[model samples]
Target chain A: MSKFKKKTATSQEIPTSALPDIIFMLLFFFMVTTVLRETEIKVEQTLPKATQLRKLEKKSLVSHLYIGKPKQPEVYGTEPKIQANDVFINPDDVVLWVNQEKDKLFEDERDQITISLKVDVETKMGIISDVQQELREANARKILYASIKSVDRE
Target chain B: MARSKRGEAGVNSAPMADIAFLLLIFFLVTTTIATNKGLMLQLPPKPDPNQPPPDINKNKRNIFTVLVNSQDRLLVEEQPLNDVTELRSMVKDFVLNFGKPDADSRALYNSLPNSMKSQVLRDPNSSDHPGEAVVSFKTDRGTSYEMYTAVLDELQGAYYEIYGDRVGISADEFRDLDRKNPEDLAKYEEAREGIPMAISIAEPSKVGGE
Candidate 1:
């Protein structure tokens, strides 16, 4: 009976050391396998007010396009040519730039593409229409326009 | 030698380590990196607050309006375009003729400048007028995700054809335009910069058929 008890004790001791190593390896494995979320561009666009707003799914691929006042061209001299600085054009240029970037980002057909257009409230319809025209030209089919939910002025 | 032969009743520690290492390697090999996708539309830099706002309303009439309702219908000035191809051609004509010196007949300008020659020639500073199309799209609020994207795709395809043709490179060759000569690359980049893809929204009217 004494010999039987001694044999059982030795068997338990072997597993004790192995248990901690297994747990540690598992923890490390999970840490390494975990995927981190990606960062996206943050810009303000006026979203239309809605009574119901749907939450997007976790894996949805959404591309962003923002339209606002055109930034002044970089000034070089003390007295920069104000004419160059003052010239404001449509958002078509920005769209073109975005399309080129999108082409590079989504080279694989397996990945889904979504375009979110964020336009300022006061911007004319013509500018947005031109953007849509450009999107069609670029073969970017999925599009979402962001608008602020309207509030009653009263 | 007699003691070594006495007992062999336990699993070896080395084998346990080997198993742990194998499991670790399996997990490492099986893990996949998550990826995101979509059309990367470049936004214009913000306007300097000190500068006065441009008069967009004054030129609204000159600008063509293409509405993509929540239903994904394409309308030009309230009239539906025949198809995506027609819309593209119409927009190409409009953008190409925007600031020409000839003032009298704007509509006739579309026919005068035969599209074949014009599509192949691109000005380095002419992103705004890529093949004569300047279109603005207003999407309704209740539009479905699929419809909105389809409309956007059609519009982008048109622009792509115009820009692609003007650059005088096939899609296959143009794909590597970035990796080509520095001057050609700069020309491509310059032509691409500052273009707009602005989309606006209005209070969605309960229109029929999405």
Candidate 2:
């Protein structure tokens, strides 16, 4: 009975030598799968809703342009603005940005690249048209208007 | 003999879990799964201001016009339409009009294949045919993006429904058809045989506040 009791006591304590290995495996999984946010969003954009929303297939073939009011309304006021990458840019500068972005991609992939316009629904069409004009000037014909799926469509 | 004594102790692995935990926390804080997706639309070529506008002398009956004002009100063929959901059914009806044989065009309802013949109705006032049908969308400058996209969705939905019906499949299934597959590509082609996507977005009018 004493021997069996001793055996039970020894088996009760669990082995933790493989704990770090398991944690490391999970760490690697998250490290590979997670895509870190590239830019700090300054503009407050609430995307419009639609039923015909399509998912963007490739990430590398797309660039995002944010248009809306600034998050910090006190400093930037309530007027809508345009945000490209890390800086706030004027509408005319969109062409230059597109050219620069196109140059970053390979020659074959440049034509396939799509520009995603993330705009607030309440924003006026004046700035949107200006951006579209600039995009045309830059020869970026494919435009994706970022929108969420409407909840009631289901 | 003294050098052999240094092998008595092994490197400690107790801190490995702490290091891994720290990394996991960092990644959890810094990483964000990308949820960005949207409605894709191709823009037309830049307009030449010096050039004169092209003449549109076609039958007004063939052109299904939709006007969205600043107040987000929709006007279909000069009639005020309140509900956005009703827009798709209206567009579908106009596109698949199956009109009578006029002096210039044949009867569109009788020209369909054996498959699509039963699904469509013959209406002399609807349209000459799907091929001749055109959807013209005009939005005011003050129209919200939400209203614009909702209207656009209904327009596309109308075409999708017609295409799905012709192909004998659900509209969602038709929309999700894999173009990369040869069979799906053939179905898509057959579905869009006479009906082309003829949505024309006109230049915004200055009716609302800029």
Candidate 3:
């Protein structure tokens, strides 16, 4: 008779103590993998596209120089400007800036450090040549032109 | 009764998941996983003002000149080519002429496997061989970076495709050959021995824009 009697179902609650632990683990994973934005880009940029693009293998070994017209035309004017690190710089100052950046690296790693030219498509070659000349003067020979993979339309 | 009261006073962690979800959503919204990639080009050493440039006796037939004007027009070997996509196969044909055998041609293509040798198309007007072939790239000051890179891509793509075909591999695989691996390193070195990238970028013309 007792066995035949209906047994009340026990409400089983899921243990959520480990939920915070899992979340914390994910948080740490994200925090460790996130690359902080290197610099605030004041210039407008639309990277050119290409087929023979190679991924820059090491983030630590590359420094970018942004060249484009300023985003805020009212403030910075329509003329293309060069932004090295976090500051606006003249093309003449590239040598000094390259030297400064090179000095930050170890001697063995210095040669491997690439100076990536992030130039807008519309930017003229004059400034680009000036930057290239400055880079040559500074003995930073490796240059990577930033580009994306072109779709059929482009 | 006191124990019951203590159990009732336990910390509420119901909002913990919500908080974590908010943070997770924030990171998911703000962060990008893909890395930026590009074309790696090595600039020639700075020229010395005191030193005169060496004269090369390269025949006009051997030099494939590509000019990008301010209007983004592509001129290949002095002939205006309207479509950029045509540049790849055109360059490949120019670089791999199998019509007549020369000393340079023999030296360049002799090492390829027999299976690959049969694939070279015979063209008398194109380059004598890969070694003798030179692709000269130049651009006007007003030429957009897009056009410049597009031309460069086609040029390099030509070499990569040739190398890949000779080695019986894809271009991406050829590029991914790890130097750290002995077999891969050997294959890469062998592939590079024949179709060396010989694009010479001339100083951009100042005729376009100031």
Candidate 4:
């Protein structure tokens, strides 16, 4: 009969001594992996879609070149402009910009630096070719035509 | 008499977990994983301003011209192709045209899937081997970015498919091959040792917007 009685001799609550440690582990993970937004993205972007794509592994070795309509059409005009960092510069300025980017990196990493062209889907290839021409002039030939993943095969 | 003999109770740590959870939830909500991936391409080196452009005479069979007009229409090998998906098979067939099947050529033929093996449509007038084949992708200024990427995707996919077949893995696995892993790096180098992807992007036709 005594065996059938309620067993409240010890605390029924789960031992939560490791709860803080577990939470802290997850907290550190989030802290370490977080990459805060650096660029303001002055231009309006709608990335094109593609199926076969390679992930850009090293963030330090990439120069982002944005080609899209200005977010405020009235101020910057409707024409799709080229944005490198903060300013929307002319196509010819790409040489200076690319060279500056190359200069910022270490000597060994300079040659391997890739230019990522994040262009709008609606954008015409005319301005894009202009940027490409400037890229050639800059001798920064390695390019990654940035795109989102697509469902369709094409 | 100077000191009280009463025992002190333990401080509560229940609120500490709650605080950590709040911060975790904030980061989870605010932080976005950067999804930066794309089709890689390499442009030709800048031509010397002082010297004349060297006009190397390439065999007509070796050059595969794909023209994308301002209207987003595709002209593949001078033939109008409506579907971009068809480019994959066309490119594979063109790349693997090993004329005069020897030991090396026979081995290449075996790498292709059983489905593709059934179609004996090798062009004698086209490229002799993967080494000589060049796919020249030409676009018009007015061509939309979507169409250009769509076409480029199909072209690159063909090469990746071939590489995956040679290494006995799927195309997705081939793309995800990390150099950090020795086995993966070996597989990658083995698959693409001689058959380099030589898709050249020619100058675009100046037609549209600034």
| Winner by TM-score | 3
RMSD score of candidate 4 (Å): 3.3
The stretch of ten residues in a row with the least summed lDDT in candidate 4 chain A is A145-154
lDDT of 1 at A61: 57
Q: Write the per-residue lDDT of candidate 3 for residues B39-63, one digit (tens) a residue.
A: 8888778888899988888877778
Residue-level lDDT tens digits of model 1 in B83-164:
6446655655455543532433243334332544454333332222422335666566444433444444445545454445
Model 4, B80: alpha-carbon shift in Å? Answer: 2.2
Q: DockQ, in order, for the candidates?
A: 0.04, 0.58, 0.56, 0.68
**Model 4 CA deviation exceeding 4 Å by range:** A1-19, A151-154, B1-9, B99-120, B180-182
The local lDDT score (0 to 100) that residue B124 gets in candidate 1 is: 35
Model 4: lDDT of residue A93: 94
Root-mean-square deviation of candidate 1: 17.5
What range of 10 consecutive residues in model 1 chain B has the weakest lDDT sum?
B123-132
Q: After superposition, how far is residue B64 of candidate 1 from its true place, in Å?
A: 2.6
- Shift of residue B27 alpha carbon in model 2, Å: 2.4
Q: In candidate 4, what are the lDDT values of residues A1-154, reduced to their tens digit?
A: 9889987898989999899889988988988888887888888889888888898768899999999999999999999999999899999899999999999999998888899999998888888888988898988888999988887654
Relative to the unseen true structure, what is the C-alpha lDDT of residue B137 in candidate 1, on a scale of 0 to 100?
Answer: 61
Error of 1 at A124 (Å): 21
Residue-level lDDT tens digits of model 4 in B151-175:
8889899999888877788787899
Q: What is the TM-score of each candidate against the true structure?
A: 0.39, 0.83, 0.88, 0.86
Query: How would you encode candidate 3's per-residue C-alpha lDDT over A89-121 as one tens digit per residue?
Result: 998999899888888898899977799989888
